[model samples]
Structures are given as structure tokens and as C-alpha cells.
Target: MLRRAGLPIGPAEILAGAEALSRIELGDRQQAQAALRATLVHRREHFEVFDQAFALFWRAPSAPGEAEAGEVELLDKAPAAARRVSEALGGGASPAPPKVEARPDMALTVSAGEQLRKMDFEAMGAGEIAEAKREIRRLALPLAARPTRRFRPNAAGRRTDLRATLKESLRQGGEVLDIRRSERVVRPPPLVAICDISGSMARYAQILLHFLHAVSNDRDRVSTFLFGTRLTNITRQLRHRDAEVAFEMVSHIVPDWSGGTRIGEALDRFNRDWSRRVLGQGAVVLLITDGLERGGPEELARLAAATDRLRHSCRRLIWLNPLLRYAGFQPKSQGVRTMLPLVHEHRPVHNIESLRSLVETLSAPQSRARMPS
Candidate 1:
């Protein structure tokens, strides 16, 4: 129950918990709960989850089917936990059929939903990962439109188009008729995502790819490339409306799915081949990696050079590092030190909340993004 709730519980902890239960009086729930928690719980952050799961799994039934809560307002979570408890305690079959259907569409309570938004991608269970995928697909990456040097025809624009006016008047025997106007082209900037798919980043990579797929289908001029030891452009593959088909296609084409990290080599390849092609017209670049270079100082120098060039080419070079979620984080790694001073913004991307912050930053004005150096 604790493991399913995202706690780092293991067989040893389970054995210790069973021994504690043996020593405690089973009739006194308080002693049993405390002893079990003392053995089972590992981290401070997982305490609330343990408490909720314990209460839901062990409390006596409020109604006929053990679905209702004893005192807590954790209604929706109770049903699933109750069902899991029933399976764990009553074998595969329930002691009595649940009278309440516990509607399949019953949405998670506000607290549980918020907890999921704040949960780390690495700590989530399989069920939470599926739920996170559905949430990621629905995210809207609406960038703030910026004006370009190019002009477009508009009836009520402030700028008068003398050339267009003359061209129009030529058809009327060169006589002045209605005035032609023009407006500066306002458009969403291009988005180019360079994501790491190394073994260390495997958990975050899968979820982020779903987000990239959504962005690819939602907007124009969005490019996605995955990198481990090599860089693979999966932008075209993600254009398919069906996500599963698109992912399968990406899997077939990308040679290095979960391999060693060669951050510099991959970025150098991208700079040589794809940068000029995609980083035009005020492009916003998202460099998603943990900045863990595999090679020595020479490789770090190459990463720095490639990153500096990339900074010059793109309008905004934002670094999204999952390692930034750690408390008291520092640029101790060679790769992190090489690239930190070059990026326009450094942000964490380990949870949905951080992604929401990214979406907001992308939608704000250009001046809102801060430069690191």
C-alpha cells in the first residue's frame, strides 16, 4: 500500500512493519499505526501519502462497502485504495459487492490533483504516469505573439502603404482612391526543443515527449529532437494526430534510445546540421538535459563552444534541467558549469508545476526572460 502510494517502501521495511505489528496490540490502532509508520516511512515528503493510504486501507467501512471515509474528506482516493485493500486482504474477490458504483469517471479530489501536479516525474507510479500523460497532452503552449520586420496588409493599420496604394491606383488611371495600409507581422516565435534521452533521464524523457507531441500538433514551426549519444529529429513523427502511432514511429527511427550521455557531441551535430535550418526568425530554444557530460575537460570545452553558438543563433536559450529540483543546487558538474552562463534562463522541469511556469514564461513578453550572464 505504501509503495503504491509513491513511498520508498521495500521488503525489508515490510518485514520490519510486520514485526512491529506482532509486538503491538492489534486492538489498539494507534500503537500499530505508529509502529508501522516508524518502520515503513523513509522520507519527510512521503509522510502525508503514507498517512492517507494507511487510513484509507485500514479504517473500518463507513457504509456497507468500505468506500466512505472515516473522518477525512479524501473521498475519491478512498474508492481506489479501498478496492486495492480488498484485493490485498480478501484475495482476488471482495467479501461483499460494493453497492456504490464509485463511478469510473469520478475525478480525483482537488487536493490529490494538486499533489500530482507537484509530484516529481521520477517518483510517480505507473498509474500516476498514465494520469500525467493525459494531463501533459492537454497542456497549451500559447506563446506571446511578437512583431516582426515583415509587413502585412490591413485595412485599419496605422502605417500607410505608398507602394500598395500606387499599385492599386494604377488600375484607376493613376487616380487617388482608397488608401492602403500595412501592419507589422505579429506571430508566435518558432520553438525548437533539444531533449536528452539518456538512461538517467529516461523517466522524464517519456513524459516530456508527450508534451512535445502536443506542442508539435498545436502550433506551427515547432521542432523536436531527442539526444542520447546521437541526435534524432522526431518533429515530423510527432505531427501525427494519434500519439501512440507517432511514438512507435519515433522509436523505430531513433537509434540511441537510452544510452550513454554525449551532450556536447549531440549539440555539436545539431549546430552543424539543424541549427541554421530551425533557429531562424526569433526562435525560442528549449535545451532539456541534466548537463552530465561523459567525457573529460576537452568535451566540456566543446559543449561550451556549441552552447555559445546556439545562444547567439536563437532569441532565447532556456536550459531546463531536472537536477535543478534538488535543494541547494550548484553548478558543480563540468557540463553544468560550461553551459550555465550561456543560457538566457535556467529552470527546473521535473514536475508539471514547473512546466506550467515554462508555459507562462513562454507566453510573457520577450523582455520578461532574464539572462544568466
Candidate 2:
């Protein structure tokens, strides 16, 4: 349980520590306990295992006195110990259980959702990503139909329908009536993600894919694609429950894993083949790339034109570029300049905070201004 909680020790170390404690000799029980504690604390790695082992050994069924309160406190605080290890290793602890708030949709509201989304991707490595995945799972929302307004009769209000109410009263021998009404909620839009898997984007692609998997499984009408030399559809592979399995499946299906980027060719394919199919129902397209096109400005221009067409077809087009993370970033590259003018929202996609921002952008209403022509 401790290991699962993110402790560094394994079972072998625990057993070894136990054996070492068993061999200790001392006159009194207190003295024996002191000796065992000293042996266990000799190395930092043994601290956690020793705490558990010492508790089990000294507090055995037939053992003399009750286990020391300090030992009990230490055992009780195992989670804190695990957290320290996690911090030292540069990974965050599992989020605390969400505080329950009294509201109409209490279950739907996640308090830690914003914090989880704001995590920095560059500072976080594999372990932090793993933890973030768990947090995403915990806060995952189920797909539900849009909310509809309820109507009830009220005594005081503007725009009264007295004629209709009177007609009903005439048929029922005159009874007082009241009414209330509210508008229905709009349904969530479909999500379309276009991730760049070219050599320049390789470093952040896999981690972003993990986030995409979480979104894909949690929502309906989610589409994912990877582009390099060619466009590869990865929506089917990401449907699996296990992230590791899903990524492995994606690897098998996408032949051009990390190679030359042909953004123009890939966008051309998506425009011709996928735009009508997946871009229907006012879907939002998340274009994730560094805007580095290998083929010169002509191909890049063609790709940007195709993307502009896609932008017109979809409800919204968001361009997520890792290059935006740099303070000195400028649209100096031909590809960046061409692609920038075509997207509705240009944002950074380097870390967790940026990803959270992407989600917020998706949820917002679409803007009316056209992409720069």
C-alpha cells in the first residue's frame, strides 16, 4: 500500500530490515526497540520499511507492552512519508479527496479540477504524468444530454398568458394557476484534435496523447489525428481503457512515428478525407504543432489554406504551439506565419496549464471574426 502510495522502498527491503531487527539482542524490550530503530534509521531508504516492519514486529499478538504512541503516529502518517518521497523525486502526491460542496450538482463540480489542469508539463516527468493521469481519472465527467429548462406557474410575472390560463380554468371550473419557465442548455460541441508528431514535436507528443486519451474516453464525438510525413488517424486506438495499451496500439498503427513533417500534405488529406466526416455538428479543431513545415512556403501555404477551409467548416479552430512557451517567441518562420493567421485562437501547448486553457477555449462560444486572409 505504501509503495502504491508512492513510497520508494520495495518488499525485499522490508524483509531484509525485518530480518536484521530479528537478530538484534538487548536486555530489555525498550532497549531492543531502540536497537531496532537505530538499525533501521541507518539508511534513508530503510526509514519507510522500518516504520512498517517495526510496527508489525513490536506489536505482534503476544508482544509485551502496547506499541509506542510515536510508532503508531508514524504508521498513521505513512501517507505523509510517501508524499515526502514523492516531492523529493519531483512528483506530486495523489490529490486530496475533494471537499464536498452543497449545491444542485455537487457531484459534477470538481474543486481540484483547475489545479490539475494548471500543472506544468516541462517540470513534470513520467511519474508526475502518471499521477496527473490518475487525477484526470478521478475528475472525469460523464457525457450527459444538455440541460432543459423547467416551467412552473407563478402569480407575479411579466408577459402573462391570461387567455390560455382562463381557457383551461373554464374547462375545470375556475382554479388559480401559476407558471415559471427557463431556457434549455446547449449541448457540448464535438472535439477534434490534430496533433503534430514530427521530429520537432516528438518530445511532447506522447504526453499530450495521454491527455487526449483522457478526453477521448470521457467525452463522445472526440476525434484524434497525428501528422508527420502523412496523416494518421488515432481515434480508434485511443478508445481502449488502459492508457499504456492505447499508446502501444497507436504506435503500432502509425507507421511514420517520428520523421519528416509534411504539414501541407497531411492537412490536404484531412481537408479532403476527414473534414466533412468529423468536422460536422460544429466540432472544434485543436491544431497542435510547432508550425514547422519541411516543404517550403508553397506547401506550407497550401497546408494553411486547407486549415483555413477546415476552420470555416468547424465551430472553432485553435492552434496550440509549443514555441509560444518561449518568452522570446516570434512568428519568424514561414510556416508559423502562414499557420498563425488561419487559426481562430492561437495559444501555447507546452504544459498542463496551457492544456487547461485549451479546454476553457473549447468550452467558450465561437468568435465571428474570420482568420486573417
Candidate 3:
């Protein structure tokens, strides 16, 4: 059962657990738990799952009426951890309790982190969001490194440096014994995030800024901008070491917050002012928005022009639209239609799973990403 919960309980660990139980008094539940846990639980995070599995697998069989008293309520009010553990034991097999409340403490509290990883951001409570922020800070953006024009000295490099080889041969009595080689330098591309802070996207934006803040502090030459009515360069503001202090600085400087979106105007501002400054060295741009433009047909032309220019300015222009969460999502809005074709990829950003996918995509193989039109 613990193995089903994704615990690393191999045959060796099982044998060890059995041997551990032999050393402790079987009648004392606490001693047995501690011994098994000491032998089987390799990770601290797996302790809860180990405890729950131990309780279920080793508990004395329930009396005739005792099982009937709480089975329905336990399943109904089960927390995410309990639900995960149940999935191992054939969850969703019973159609019984639709609204029964279970005991929180006694309920299996396993897989909470797994549940959190898949949870939608907007649906999360304050505590969950806080937990998520800590998780985000721990993430390392897996940005692939691109080969630069300049070459560096390397013994295993393909290209031979004739000049260096000759110089080194002088030390060997003018004998060209070994040819020195050099390889093109490889460096991770700069990352720039242009996020929407419009009323509709504010909640997702709030969460993404935490992610961006972590990214900004993690590496060098990362830039960030916030756009609603106009584009506000937040690269400087987000550079603060403290996330809370950095966001406070951004909140003070940015004039438009949770306001109407101006897709065309914001892109124009980015293309004209910041493109040349930051979009150098194969920069990867993350354009986050919902694509619900409030502009007219005329503005759509400008939107198309700006998006095209921005796309040309960067190596990869990824559109992280929260609207893509919908199953039947389409580029029906003027803004999305104008921007979608210009981007290398159009992906969702509504949940943690999507965010993790984005991280994976960024760290993908050197070849640029190309999503379907």
C-alpha cells in the first residue's frame, strides 16, 4: 500500500522493515511505527504516507458495526492526501457517501504536495498560495544554453586552434605532439516576462509575479514587465532580494493595477522602448495574458504589428494565455487572433501543472518549440 502511494519501498526496504518490527514489541503500536518508519521512510516528506499506510495495513480488524459507522463519512470528507491513498486502494469504486464528513486527523494525510502541484492557482486558499510560493522559489528555471560566436579553450572541442597548438608544441622541443582545441562558448539565454495585470488576469498575475520574482533572482540578465493600460518595466523593482519588498516597490511605481487591458498599446511600448535593450542574445520572452482585448478593429492592426515585431525581436516568443485552460478555447478575440500566429507557442498558465510544464518547456532541448497554429 505504501508502495502504491509512491513511497520508495522496495523488496530490500520491506525485508528491513520486517527485521525492524522483530526488534520492537508488536503490541506497542508506537514502537512498531517508529521502527518501520526508521527503516522504510527514506524521505521526511514520505513520513505522513508511511504513517497512514502503517495504520491501515497493521490496525486490528474493525468490529462488525465499526466498519459501517465511518466508511462512508471517511470517504466523503477525505482530504486530498486521504483521497490519494484511497486511489491506491481503488478509489471512485464506491458511489456511497456523497456528503459525509470524515475525521481530519485520523484521515490519511499523504500526497498533499502532489495534490498541491496539480491544484489551480485561482482556486487555492491563502495558505495554499503561501505554500506554493515557497515551492516556486525552490524551482530552478531549466533554460537551455545556446552556443555563442566566441570560442573557448577545450581539450575535447571539435575545432583545433593552430596558434595555441604551435605555442604548446614549443614546450615539447618543437614537436606538434598534441593539437589544442577550442569550442564555441555556450550560455543560457536571457529571460524576459511581459505579464498582464488587467482585471481579468489579476489573480493569475498575482501568482505569476512570485514565480517571476524567483526567476529574476535566480539568474543574470532577466527582465520583467507588467502591462494593463501601459507597460511598466519591473525589472529594476523585482531585483530586490526580498520578494515582499520587491513587490511593494512594484506596487508603488506601477500606476495601472487591475485596470482595463490595452494589448496593442502595451506591445507597442515594449517593442519601441525595451526590445533593443533586453531582447538581445536569443532572449526568451514569456507573454502572459488572457487575450481578451477591449480594443476595436483598427487597434487589432496595431496589435498584429506589435506582436510581429516582438516575435521577431526574440528567439522564442511563448504566449502563456490563461484562457487556454478552457477545452474549447479559440482565438476568437481580436487580441488573441492577432497575437497567436506570431508566437512560437501558445500555452496555458492557469495552474501549477501548467507552470511546471512551462519550466520544462524552457529547459527543453536546444531546438525551438513550435506549437500547432
Winning model by lDDT: 1
lDDT of 1 at 148: 82
Q: Look at candidate 3 and tell me the lDDT of residue 200.
A: 77
Q: Rank the candidates by lDDT, best first.
A: 1, 3, 2
Q: How many times do residue backbones clash in model 1?
A: 0
Ranked candidates (TM-score, high to low):
1, 3, 2
Cα lDDT of all candidates, in order?
0.82, 0.67, 0.80
Q: Which candidate is the best by TM-score?
A: 1
CA lDDT of 274 in candidate 2?
Answer: 88
**Candidate 3 per-residue C-alpha lDDT over 133-236 given as tens digits, one digit per residue, 9 for 90 to 100:** 88888778978888878898999999999999999999999999998999999889989999998767776888889999988888998999999998999999
Considering only N, C-alpha and C atoms within 3 Å, which residue pairs clash in candidate 2?
Answer: 152-179, 152-180, 153-178, 153-179, 154-178, 154-179
Global Cα RMSD, each model: 11.3, 16.5, 18.2
When summed lDDT is taken over every stretch of 10 residues in candidate 2, the lowest stretch is: 1-10
lDDT of 1 at 309: 93
lDDT of 1 by residue, 1-373 (tens): 5544444454667899999999989999889888988888754544555666677666665563554434235534454443333333332433574677566544644677798899888766546777998998999999988788899999999999999999999999999898999999988989999999876776588889999999999999999999999899999999999999999899889877655789999999999999989988899999999998979989988999999999899999999999989988989988888889888899999999999999998888786357542
TM-score of each: 0.71, 0.56, 0.65
